[model samples]
Target: MTRMPFKKLALSTAAAGMIFGAALPASAAGYTDVPKESSHHDNIVRANELGIMTGYGDGTFKPNGQLSRGNVVKALGKYVVKHSGLTPEEYVKTYGTASVPNFSDVPNSWADQELVMYSKIVKDMGIFKGSNNRLMAGNLITRDQMAEVLARTFAFRDLPGAPEISDIGGSAYAKSIEILFENGISVANPYHPRATTSRAQLATFLVRSYDKVSKEESVMPASFYSELRKGKVSDAIVQIGSTLTELKKKAGDPEAEYDFEGGIRHVYGKYEYGVPHPVLEEGDPVTTVTYYFDEEPSLEEVMRHMGPVEQTEEEEDPMEYDYLWYHKGDFEVFFEYEWGGDTIDNVTVKSNR
Candidate 1:
């Protein structure tokens, strides 16, 4: 599994599009306090609704506070359920500083469950560190530090073809930074993509990234769900047709047709790709595109292939292009292309998640 840099891309800079067409409104949904216009408003709301995050004591989620290691754990505890991997108590016993009793600073009360849970996630994630053997959970997390932690949490470490680096400066956490950008997890960079990140920004970023990771996998949104639920009979029919057309080619069955369920079409075909196409007895209901690797590519190959390219201002700039390299794998893909007459520079990749 390669972990590519996922957030270092250029901003597409399209005008504000409509809100997420399928999700409920933020204020009405009891998910977050930020306004919809804020880049992370929906993410905060969604994380709250899913029981993955909460606002600060002031009834606000300070979107710009510097994050602390303890705070990071507190936020992550919202989702670290007990499982075969490890239990919360076990994590605390294993990772808690020996000098501090398990309940020290954490009252041995039911309200302290969050602290305990956070301790476990931090431990399991290998992010708990302290000064002189004391787990300094209270330390403020720096920008690059947060990046390294995020990359590890998402299993972006040891990507199949990660680049060799002497150091990412003090910013070892640069790997996970992309998760923040691709999902619109944070907007610390309102006008620029590579701007420095703050702690409060990191908090919101974690909340949103965790929320998205918990959702269904590898399924693009199908417009048919909303159309069918709204009783737009004509629209539903059209979508169904379009979906069928899209899947027929992928599934490689000329005779394939589909039935709809659970907001997705259940299409059966002899194969999923590399098949013959047939004219639909009905009109073309769905159109689909398939992404084929031009070759049996590896991270090393991608890096080698792209190493000599330069950024073209006439084309997408470096920041906007960063995410493309990281989206495919854990290798934290970087672009060393020349930009604006500079001979060399690097950027992370961003994903739309």
Candidate 2:
């Protein structure tokens, strides 16, 4: 847990892809201490604009100042509200009125009320923890601790393919740190997870985390669909949203066909090098792409590529799950997950017609 020297880190690929609309605009003279040439200037400005972090009344942002745990919780509470779509009033109503204390150190005093509430909320969500009934609110938070907070806040564990961190494999925050790296939030090679984070560093991390979540909730751009409509199909399209007509055009003809109730089922091998290999037997090691013109593609496929459904209907039947819907730009996609099965039986994507 030795601290590594701070160096200029590059903006992550995910951070670069973020729509500026997701973050507030930066002011030219946001903070006196943060020079325009500072590595963390953009993030600090963005955080200030978003009201996630701020400076002193004298217009100086102590960029290199150590961030306290209480302050971190306060900032993260605002972020959680934004990321989870909770109104500020709703958040206050939910956590503000609770009289029960989760930590012995967090007294019922008015001075500590806000921090205590936020601490309880984050703790309930498994983001923050206390040892020996004390939250250590005054202590400066470490980089690894920050990782755990972000990871739990955004539920980053569900994201696929977490990368390995050479130095922090054995730490308690290892998995969370890996998620941070995998999502392009932390680009530091020797991540220095145990080092105390500065206000500037924390601001950068929070803004990047927000960007990552925004990207996850986003769908493929309209330009992508325009390419798909023109029969320009690629591996990227398969991983996201695409029409059966487009998939057929990309994969060519199907090897086998079967009659279903409403439409014909066309089955194609997972094509590689312009060749479609056949499935010899049940459970064979082969790539299968099934397209039912009357029905949509698999639910798993849609969710896998398009992220989670934004809305879902409540189920009337106790045994059944609700139908899910996603609206991405001009596209509307629907999915129905079958009972006792991972595959989504029905999917339909419609454009503004």
Highest TM-score scorer:
2
Candidates' TM-scores?
0.38, 0.53
Write candidate 1's Cα lDDT for 142-238 as tens digits.
6555655554444322333333333343343544444344444434432222344453355355555554443423121122111211222211113
The predictions' CA RMSDs to the true structure, in order, are: 16.9, 14.7
Candidate 2 on 1-353: residue-level lDDT in tens? 21111111112232232121223333447887899899899988886765556666667778898888887876665454443333656655643425435777887664877676777655543456677868899999999998877655554433455566678976887877877787678888788888998988987887876565444423333233223322332343232233445555566666766644333445554321111234233222211222222333333334333333457665767688556565544445555565433345544443432
What does the lDDT read for residue 123 in candidate 2? 55
Off by over 4 Å in 1: 1-33, 56-59, 82-121, 157-170, 176-200, 215-353
Which portions of model 2 miss their true places by more than 4 Å? Answer: 1-26, 82-100, 157-164, 218-353
- Model 1: what TM-score? 0.38
Q: How accurate is candidate 2 locally (lDDT)?
A: 0.55
Least well predicted 10-residue stretch by lDDT in candidate 1: 7-16
